[model samples]
Target chain A: MSLSEFELIQRYFAEASTDASVALGIGDDCAVLSVPTGQQLAVSIDSLVQGTHFLEGTPADLLASRLFGSALSDLAAMGATPAWLTLALTLPEPDEDWLQLFSSRLAQLCNEYHVSLVGGDTTKGPLTLSAQVHGFLPRDHRLTRAGAKVGDLICVSGCLGDSRGGLDGLLNGFENHTEAGYLLERFYAPTPRIELGKILLGKANSCIDISDGLLSDLSHILKASGGLGARLQLEAVPISSQLIATFGEESARQWALTGGEDFELCFTLPPNYLALLSQLPVPVAVIGKVTDRADIELFLRGEPCQIQGSGYDHFQRKDD
Target chain B: MSLSEFELIQRYFAEASTDASVALGIGDDCAVLSVPTGQQLAVSIDSLVQGTHFLEGTPADLLASRLFGSALSDLAAMGATPAWLTLALTLPEPDEDWLQLFSSRLAQLCNEYHVSLVGGDTTKGPLTLSAQVHGFLPRDHRLTRAGAKVGDLICVSGCLGDSRGGLDGLLNGFENHTEAGYLLERFYAPTPRIELGKILLGKANSCIDISDGLLSDLSHILKASGGLGARLQLEAVPISSQLIATFGEESARQWALTGGEDFELCFTLPPNYLALLSQLPVPVAVIGKVTDRADIELFLRGEPCQIQGSGYDHFQRKDD
Candidate 1:
């Protein structure tokens, strides 16, 4: 059935939000929300295009999962509580099956993340989805990229670059069933470190998400922190065993250091806050230290190392 | 030179904001903002595609102005104060000239509206732009579509159908110099009725923006207000003299009734609140009245009349 914009929204996106913070949701020209008193609002917007961000025939459910997973990761990096999201989706035409799967997965994710889908606009064009997320943070507290100081310890949560390995395996085909399944799952449903981000809110000096690889994302933190530098012990970077077994340790380590789309948290802590690291709900590794020097130095097993590529750039990809 | 996303944002979008509500602008995982206490937050997102929304080879500056003007009209409809915006822009390639024009016009509009360009994401794809705007409203007050009662007077701010006339002139070419210029200007740069909306905040019973022709948009307000109907006096519908001279009386009336993209405000007020209409800064026409009937009735000079088209729908345009 060819659905009008109003009918489409009424059918799929008119789920009433029970959250008290949402004074108004879908159906209005603008969504009205209540940001709790004594809290600042944090917002982030990201877009995913058909060919640029995903394969052409990627399943609608997996695409929704990955899109929202990556977008919400920004909120996770900020130590903010994800509260609401607005989606602007463009499609070449209305496909019932695709809309069903996409909206269902998106609704599921919103429920899982405790965020209400507040508003959306659907248009006709090439397949592209943009999501703007709104969240809340304590007014006095901030977890930013500019706070990492010299002598601070740099850390990352969970495994890095498994999503990259998954992409590679999906492209080249994997030999091991168990490893391929694990890698693909990670790629399709990468978790954002929201809890860990909140835990580090007051303690972590600076924070960023590992979307553009550990090296590149960490460089952003360093650069934002007044041209500071970092010394990363390559051996300390976390790599999943599945990724290492599927693609050898060398390839896995390279991906962990430079592959993009992991959605894990990379943050800095003052040496005194080391105790909080052990109390984290998720596994974390101290991979480096912030330095006064002006360049990022890499060490593998205590020996200086060099890598071939940096993180992905939208306009100028390293591989391109 | 091909620019990375970070460099593009830093060069074009990193204007320092004097707005105190913006706690942090570009150069971070997310934009941090402070919504004043005792106020509710209002958010709206809109997407414009190259082929669907505007003609190919449209000037970058004009395109930017039109996109923002149409999007901010949502905030105006809600009677909210526009405060911040996040842009997710996708481009096939980085064209310095296009970027300069687009970003410059965008900056000008942000300054004009007192809204900050807080954060943005630049990606590689077919040209598509999505903007999410955040604004603020008094917690206890609202001007919504669902509150219009049967006896309310329906009024509209500014002339209608001039943008449609402009579009027609653009496509078919116009003869009158002054009228053509006025219509083309209207088509290219729509002014969102923000100040008028704020004035209507608690006083007006219900309000909506005229994006998709008067008939279509007012129908939305009527439908949302529990299926109430309206009686529109066709002669009273405001049509600019320029549009009438250019398109003739019948065609101009039809366009005034159904043309989209005008970005004016259509609101309803109880009869007791009619005095506020004359006091409005902009010229307003009381074109209709809400009624208990379930169907819209049109009359011209006290005689029943019929119009050809209703309004614009994104998925199924009437002209299409």
Candidate 2:
């Protein structure tokens, strides 16, 4: 039997939300949520299209995981606790089997992240998924990109460029080596650094998730912080062993600098707070320092070097 | 100059939010909002596709108003005070003039409704607009569809079926008569009955926005309230003079009973609380009463009547 929109929601996503914060979940014109007295809400939205963001044949569970993790990373950048989620899922048609796996993975993530799947709308259109995540932080407390000072030390969590490498391998059809498999996993399921965000709440001067690569996202911090700039010690940039083995050190380093979809957190901290890095849940790399210069400068082995691509632009034609 | 995603946001949507509740607005990883103490958050999301929701040549400002007004109606149904909005705007390409008109109208609506344009994502894809609206209500105080009791008086705010008439006129290319123009306006910009929603709070037993026509939306209330049904007095159903003139009384009545996208409120009230109807901001019609039966029964001049095409379902094929 063909499923109507109501039946589709009832069968696949009815029980996807079971968080205490959701006073009313699904089936309503609006989902009602209870906010704690002392907490503020942090909300972010991300959209993933079939051809623009991923291949058409991508697995349903993996797509759900990728979209959820990347969206939640925005809250992680704000040092906020994940609380609620709303989705607007547009599909070309009602694919029951695809929806089953997608919603199962979504529910699992909601459980893992302790977020309530409060509401969603299912519509018929070209395949596009928009996920809005709402997180909470104590009143008047948050990490913003505008707090980086000229002397602050720039830092990043985890090795960058693995997701980009994974995308590259997927496009080129790499052999099923262990390294290739690791990169594929990175592309499919990124870990939102929520716990690390919590640890850096008070100490980090500024923070942002590395979604459009370290260079692009870090430049946002610089631009937001009164046009302050940064100098990166390219030698200190971290690269995973698997990524290096698959794509060579030179390409891996370039991807670390300019590749996108790395959901790791990049932040700035004062020199006095450097000791706090030792207590972080993930490995920390101090690769650069904020500068007064107004533009990013790169130096490798004591010599300046130029990068090829600045970052991803959804509108501007890449070649131009 | 061709605009990148960042440039487009900075140029068009940077100043869209100025509400005090927004601690941080556009240009942040997550927009931080200060939810007032003793208030719960109410959220809803709606998506409008290019071919599915509207025609290709629809004016940008009209499209913006339609999407925003319709999305906000969900909060209105819950008796929540509208507050913040996030848009996931997927466009085929960035047309500067179109963006100007669209964003200008969106900013105007934000001002008119006291809603902050907190944050949004712009991407290159098929033209699909998804809007997620946030609102605030008193803690533990909300109108749910499950609250209706059998024998309650059924009430509807404003005239219904005008939007459907408007849509039909548009699709059929009606002459530019005054009635046709009114119906077109109704189709392009249906008002959200937020004030009436506030008036219904604490008095109405249950309430919902009539988006998917009377039968379909009321059926939701019935199912939510444990299968209690309703009986409609067809003569008492309100239809606009414009709709009746544009489309004969018979078709208008049918549309009033079963047409969708009206964006009006439908609620149930106890007989003792019937006097509250006089205090509503909009005209309301008492066209029905709750019943113990599990299916809607309609009466026309004391005789049984039947209606066709229950309502719009996104996934269900119309032929089925």
Candidate 3:
């Protein structure tokens, strides 16, 4: 256990300050920030646990990136430009290397997005992290998950579920040159689609990032819009070629449909804005459409099929 | 320990409706918010741990209120209007009654402040809570701790050390109500001085909320404003008359000097605004003045006395 909380914060949580927009950073009671004028701020918070969120010996930098990426996914969903973040970390003990890796990666992410580390809390307990992020959205341009019309096209950025496949490999020590390992890396270091989010602010109707499986996460958009459901085209759901080569079709399908932690944007757009959506800096592929049916479903070549068991139900489970 | 993470959030966290200004509330990857035009947002986060910050078996509603008040004090210090908040709660199990009490008090706080509970995380683990709050500030006036200048009058709202006295009574179970019991209640249900904060926003040059002991927290103002110190009148440090009567002058004085957890506002006003400060709504008593000496001193009838230790240092004796 850490000897003291103050030392723990200094050692494990304080990131190197370079171009931090924070008027006052951590070490104070609260972090103070100056937001740019004419911009509305988007805010989100997420917590990740050790045994549950990651494997026992996961790389610290990778874990840091993945957690931040998960929270950043919310900004992307809102089409908000990244701004600043605060962290609350509870740990079992102080580890020097872990702190170094975590801080370095945090600094890297902050620099990449021009965001700053504003404030945080560090405590000694079970290892867990909760991050609260702030971002800027233009007036009347904040993307939401509630505006998807029935005819709007459903789109997803990047492939989904390779992170789960990677975890399977990590647990079973399965190795494949195909995309599972690559997808795992993708899962671990998802590049937050900041630019794409900015472009879709007003262009997209309803938006969400797929951290859970597609059906589970996309259901949020459907429910938010007061829409009945969406019909996801299984074949059209993007899967990395590497994932296909390694996990094979059946396993890849399982991962894509049910496995989660991809941190990809799963959003809806008006059909008329297809050109605009296609022109986004990141690849955005339409794979489904909102429908009047209340029952969310998956269609494989126009035939109804079960959606890999509600796509990661916390109350339900698959026996490995 | 718990069944699943989603169930935890759904059961303990998911509100039927944020039903407030939450453009998009919980259940999405991130919560989307709308910032009213022309108003800047103030943000702060604080995490509390069991056995470190509070004793086990603390009243659930009191815990929730205390934690919320801690964050509110930050907003109060910033002279910001309350807006939205997110909570990250980790626990060993789902105690139904505890959740009921906690959520109830949380709802009360939200409704009282006109703030919405936007997003949060609930997980099974050792007990910890991180509350992140966002508030709005007026265009060019943010009362920062760094704005105090020479000849500024230092002032505080509400009495000090009551909470510390209360916590001591609770922890050691010193049931004699002669005075400690009131102190304990004061600590448990601290008033965040929101009204006082707004009243002083324009009149005060520098400001901070005293969560740590007054002497230590006030030092933040001094340090922020170039290490300019002040001489505080021992008599002027507010203490409840009942406390002095019950515990006698010596113990109450000790508590006033080094005990903490009082979420009161401490601010500085230039002499030019001194008359204006005196006319403010709350009793904003000028207890001291900024001085050239770089070390804080306490005066009891013109006799200089040593303050034994830093206020609220958890690991060391305050008088050591």
Tens-place lDDT per residue, model 1, B1-320, is 01255355446545546678889888789889999988899899998898888778889898888889988999999999999888898988878788888888888888789888888888889999888888899996777888999989999999999999988887788766578888988888899889999999988889999888899888888998999999999999999999989889888998898988899999999899888888988999999999999889999999998988798776676345
Model 1 stretches astray by more than 4 angstroms:
A1-16, A175-177, B1-16, B175-178
Please give the lDDT score for candidate 1: 0.86
Question: TM-scores for all candidates?
Answer: 0.96, 0.96, 0.87
Q: Write the per-residue lDDT of candidate 3 for residues B147-263, one digit (tens) a residue.
A: 888788888877777787777677665546777657766877777777778878887889988866788878878987888899888888888786676566787788887777788
lDDT of 2 by residue, A1-320 (tens): 01255345445545555567788887788889887778888999899988778888899999999999999999999999999888898889888888888988887887788877777888888999999999999999999999999999999999998998998898886544679878988898999999999889988999999888899999989999999999999988899999988888888998998887889999999999988879889999999999999999999988998888876666663452
User: How would you encode candidate 3's per-residue C-alpha lDDT over A1-320 as one tens digit per residue?
Assistant: 11244344444334534433455556544555665666656788877777667767788898889888888877888888888888887766657677778877877777677777767766656678888888877655688777888888999888776777787777675557545558668767877877888788777888777766777777767877885688888899888777777778888888887787787888888899988865778777889888999767788999998844656542233332
* iRMSD (Å), candidate 3: 4.0
Per-candidate interface DockQ score: 0.62, 0.61, 0.34
Give me candidate 1's TM-score against the actual structure. Answer: 0.96
> What fnat does each of the candidate structures reach?
0.82, 0.80, 0.43
Q: After superposition, how far is residue B288 of candidate 2 from its true place, in Å?
A: 1.1
Candidates in order have lDDT scores of: 0.86, 0.85, 0.74
**Could you give candidate 2's per-residue lDDT for residues B132-245 as a string of tens digits?**
999999888888898999989999988989998988887786644678878877888888888888777788889989888888888888889999999999899889998887
User: Candidate 1's residue-wise lDDT over A106-194, tens digit each?
Assistant: 88888788988888888889999899988899996879998999999999999987898888887778756678878888898889788
Clashing pairs in 3: A179-A242, A179-A243, B91-B125, B163-B187, B166-B184
